[model samples]
Target: MVTLPIEFRTPLTEGDVGALGVLERDGIRFEIDSGRLILIAPRTLWHADACHRVANLRPYAYGRQGMRISRTTVRCPDVMVLFAEPDPDASCHDPADVAIVVEVVSPDTAVEDRVVKPRIYAGAGIPEYWIVDRHPTDPRDASVEHFKLGVSGAYQRIGQAALSELEKTG
Candidate 1:
């Protein structure tokens, strides 16, 4: 049987640094947070699709796999969309430029996505975030939980919506 390569991290930078130059290097997937590097592995289809939909946005889509942002480097849902005109000086690491962020949940990542990520995204003022639940017993239906940043610095659940709704909105 073929085995997948295990995901791992290599030290690159220090502190809450923002730019990570090692991602383009050979063999590792890196997410650059402020200054630290979190190594990740390539994502699955469900995760990539979630990011793609956000990128093929009406105005213009830019989907970046395993890009770093703020102090947390997220995999898969790392894609961001810009609905308006593009900024010449726009950087993927910039928190304000992101229209939406998506995260796919697995048993290992559920806690981080549910508890930690929201705080990070909210703190960055990321506007919108979608959490895709891929649990086995939760029905094969592709349901996504949406969240919008509230004034209180917490992600307010926009409730769960079918993938169809996302298609329509897009």
Candidate 2:
């Protein structure tokens, strides 16, 4: 992990290219909460593969794309499936334009992936959210949890499927 700069501790506004540079330079993941930047763990190979698999499913789906959840928060989801083609000139897509968001969980990010992101994504009115539990120890043990936003603006656990099963059919 690259050393986090001291400046990142402060709150930032939208479209901060410098913060985006920090992400690129450090090779660390970031999630902005109320303009307060938070660190995400380095992704494992399994996590990356899961992202690729999800991205490959749809032509409009992309991996590691920045998204604006609110005016003050910018998050880069592991995989994003958009309803329509993204604007080429925009730095990040608005939450309303995203059809689904996928997070591939690592050991250090399990709680954030399973708990924090679901609430945030659901509140943003994203239709679907997927959490991929990529088992590092046992590839066969990996599974994905599917959540769908309910009318009350919360995510409800809908289904789960093993990664092995998906590979067989994918």
Highest-lDDT candidate: 2
Across residues 120-162, which tens digit of lDDT does each residue of candidate 1 receive? 7787778888787753344443567888998898889878876
Q: Could you give candidate 2's per-residue lDDT for residues 1-170 as a string of tens digits?
A: 56544455456657564446667666766767787777677777777888887777667898767788877788899999999998876657888899999988877777888889888898888999988885556774567788899988899889988766666776
TM-score of 1: 0.68
Residue pairs that clash (backbone atoms under 3 angstroms), model 1: 16-34, 16-35, 17-34, 17-35, 18-34
Q: On a 0 to 1 TM-score scale, where does candidate 2 land against the true structure?
A: 0.83
Among these predictions, the greatest TM-score belongs to 2
Full-model lDDT for every candidate: 0.60, 0.79
> What C-alpha RMSD separates each model from the true structure?
5.9, 3.1
Instruction: Give per-residue lDDT, candidate 1, residue 23.
Output: 42
TM-scores, in order shown? 0.68, 0.83
Lowest lDDT 10-residue stretch of candidate 2? 1-10
